[model samples]
Target: MKYYIGLDIGGTTIKCGLVDETGKIIEKDSVKTSIKGEEILQNIETIVSQFKSEKPITAIGVSAPGIVQKDGFMTTGGAIKDFFGINLKEEIEKRTDIKTTVENDANAAAFAEQWKGNAIGFHNYYCMVVGTGIGGGLIINDQIYRGGHGMAGELGMMSVMNVDNDQHLELNSLSFTGATVFGLLNYYNHHSDKPEVTDARVIYELADKKDKLALESLDFFYTALAKGIINLMVALDPEIVLIGGGISANSQFMEGLQAKIADLKSRNSDVRDLTFAEVKPAKLRNDAGIIGAVYRAIQAN
Candidate 1:
């Protein structure tokens, strides 16, 4: 059986995994992300060497943050400032002498869903990863739609609020300062005089306990997110809208979001006319990037 190495590079950690052709993870590990570009590459090389000692790796796949071109060039590396303007595929191939493929993290997640996760058999769908901010991936006609310059699925940049002034419109974007976990915590902490909480889970628990401030903040979050999903539904009309991220694992959050969407649809006649896409939690979760990257590698080879 041919084996592959998948690496998911994030701001905090670089998650690595070994897998065969069938999408099953054989082993997985992670290393703390480094600020320096060379250090990150070295870490990747070390991981590849360790994995290679155990099995002959056929290729390497990478799932990375920021705007990645089809040729594996990172136009903007998100939190990884050092990755900007670099060709990661060539770099990895040079270091490890293995064929390598690179993909955007959110798009990789969508690929994971298409391959073996919640989006299987769906010809068209959207995947949104809601965390500190939001990231999106679009699958059209069973293919990842990387638009001109590879900036197709940037859903977080969509403005949900109107501003009198043009400047700082990104601040009013759906996910930037509104419909995310960070936004929820920010809203709660700013409004509540009670000792500030950092975690979104804590706020959720407070809401469960009927804390007025927490409930209000969650209402804002749910409303903003519902509006964003509504916009996506009206525009793309996908078969399903899959949500991913740490918060998606919380059943309460998912149920609340679904309920909020339903409430909105019932209130709006225009939205009611549009076919509603089923909102579901992504099945792959943490392993999505790794599995999707490997899937891309498999396709490349």
Candidate 2:
């Protein structure tokens, strides 16, 4: 039985796990992602050793937040500045003397969904995660399709506005967390004259309680999110568009979103088969990235 390691290197923590070809996380572990590459590499090496103590590992796979190149290099992203221009593949190999591969966390999550999660057997689809930030993955013909420069799935930053538009609104302004924060703080500023309320959790808690301002915040989030999904669908025309993230866990939001999408589609009957991307919760949730990372490693070999 060939064993593999999946490493999810997020901005805050590194989730490492051992798995077989079946995608079950056998032995899981994690560590902090340090600023120094040497220190981070050492942590990865230790995890590999720990996993290897019981299982005979054949390869390693890594999932990080960036555009992963085919040349075993991950591009630096907006959130994690420490990984910029770093040859993470080389560093891990140097530490463990084992070959490995890396991919974008979004892409990894999408792959896991397609391979073993909710979006399985779908020929063409996109996966979006509206968590701390907005991002997603693309799959075509049952495979992760990283277009042109392996950055095709960076949907959040792709044309939130039109050309020659002076007062264009970038989509991030309406991100899941951003919308909630804006509404809360905007309300507080106008009402109580406070500083800011940036946490989405507060928005969730308040909304659950049916707070007037928090309800408005939830509307802001769902509206933008529903609009984003509709726009993505018009472009990609995928059969299924899986939605994930912390906020996606809310059933109320999901049902409301489906209604919003249906209403939007009803307004445009002439446009193709009027269908919205089915919004479903992520199956593996947080573990999808690490499992997908392991899948990539074994496939690369």
Candidate 3:
């Protein structure tokens, strides 16, 4: 009946949860991530102190972005400039005197899917999270594959399109730029004079209504997403690619991505011959980072 404190650190928010060994969330809370390194540590200390005050905690696990080492050393913080070159494990352990483990956020999500959600009993798969930007986790042979420097699975930086135009194409140049929710909204607003679209659902709804701009924007998104999925499939040859994020809730997004893949297969005989990995939405949504972080802590302990 031991409990673990799990922290899911992101650019905007830090989600903290007290989770049991069985992957059940006993209690959860969150706080804004401060840009300053010390403030971020203070926020984590506050949350961990509150959780510890109420329950007996064995260890702490954290899911973070950028290059996170097995020893919890963050060499490069993707969005949080303050975390660069910090050993977060020692920082938390010194304050709380509890063993801690840290993992990359996307890798943690992939582990969550294998542990208690979709991709259960699967040996190999890739997990991709699409949001402001794309994040990916590669699981090969049932284990998270951190590259030589523990910086693997960065799918967003992959170059997908190089559309040549007289105007600057920097906005839609990369895979992440073309396939993300922010990209969709930006593209939509860039084209139309209407009030800027805030939510991805608005774009989806407009597409469903046969709005030409919406449809065109979504078409670009699906094409880029399909190419990214194919790139993973061809490179990793995983059994399936589990997609997770806010937009994964929408059924049409998956359908659209699949349609693009199908179209690719129809035209490219090699793609047809080499069976692409099946794409499925992640069963666990936001709680994935918590569960997976707890899982990593337990395993490390």
Candidate 4:
């Protein structure tokens, strides 16, 4: 029964899981993410030690946020600024005296889907995780395609709008500012005269009740996200587009997003001839990174 330690490092927390070779998580836990790199490393060590004490771990796998190179180097660490230029795989190996493999968080999620989730039979697909911001992963021909320099599938960086206000050119990409939960809240609060709500779920609930402000904000969110998906559909023409994140659990959100995409495609003549990829919610959900990391570890062995 070979076991692996899976770590999902995010801006707010580090989710830890002990997974068997079969991809089932035997146990799971999490710890607060630290702004300091050293503290983060120590946290990983602690989690590894705890998990190793209970099982004979074969290797460690990490789902890390940011632009991760193939050899486990962090070119940019997203919210964890301290991780820039650090080789997390080497760091974990040094701390635990065990083999380690690291992958981009979004890519890990996509891998999870390909392994045992909604994308089991699909070889070509795209995955987008929409939350505080948008993260993307691409699977082409049954392999994760991490383009030259490992920056491929960075969907959030794709510019959706060109702002030319005040005689200055500005580009708005699909990110926290426009297409995610953060964007929805910001847009809603900015327009609503009542008290601002921080939770995106609240806005969804309001929209369910036919609240005007919430509906408007959600429309904006879906429109922005649909546009991004439309762009991907035309360019990649994947078999499917799997969306992952906490918000993806909401059936309404998924339906609304697909509806918006259909609306946009109906109005566009150029893309009408292209076959659109089916958009579906990811199955692994919160456990995606953990399961995906473990799957990567299994492959490494």
Identify the candidate with maximal TM-score: 4
Q: Candidate 1 vs candidate 4: which has greater TM-score?
A: 4
Give the distance in Å from residue 141's predicted Cα in candidate 2 to where it truly belongs.
Answer: 1.3
TM-score for predicted model 1 compared with the true structure:
0.95
The parts of candidate 4 lying over 4 Å away from their true place are 162-171
| TM-score ranking of the models | 4, 1, 3, 2
In the predicted model 4, the residue pairs found to clash are none
RMSD to the hidden true structure, all candidates = 1.8, 3.6, 2.0, 1.7
Identify the superior model by lDDT, candidate 2 or candidate 4.
Answer: 4
Q: What is the lDDT of candidate 1?
A: 0.89
Candidates in order, TM-scores: namely 0.95, 0.85, 0.93, 0.95
Relative to the true structure, candidate 3 reaches a TM of 0.93
The digit string of per-residue lDDT tens for model 4 on 96-146 reads 999999999999999999988999999999989887778999999999999
TM-score of 2: 0.85
Q: For candidate 2, lDDT tens digit of each residue in 51-90?
A: 8788888999998877777666767644666677777788
Once model 3 is optimally superposed onto the true structure by TM-score, how far is the C-alpha of residue 206 displaced, in angstroms? 1.5
**Comparing candidate 3 with candidate 4, which one achieves the higher lDDT?**
4
Tens digit of per-residue lDDT, candidate 3, span 98-202: 899998888899999999889898899988888777788899998899989887888877767665577565444444455455567777888899998889999
**Per-residue lDDT of model 1, residues 1-301, tens digit only:** 9999999998779999999999999999999999999999999999999999999999999999899998999998978899999999999999999999999999999999999899998999999988777888999999999998898988888877554585676767877555455578877887887887878889888888998988998888888788888999988899999998878999999999999999999899877776789999999988999999999999999
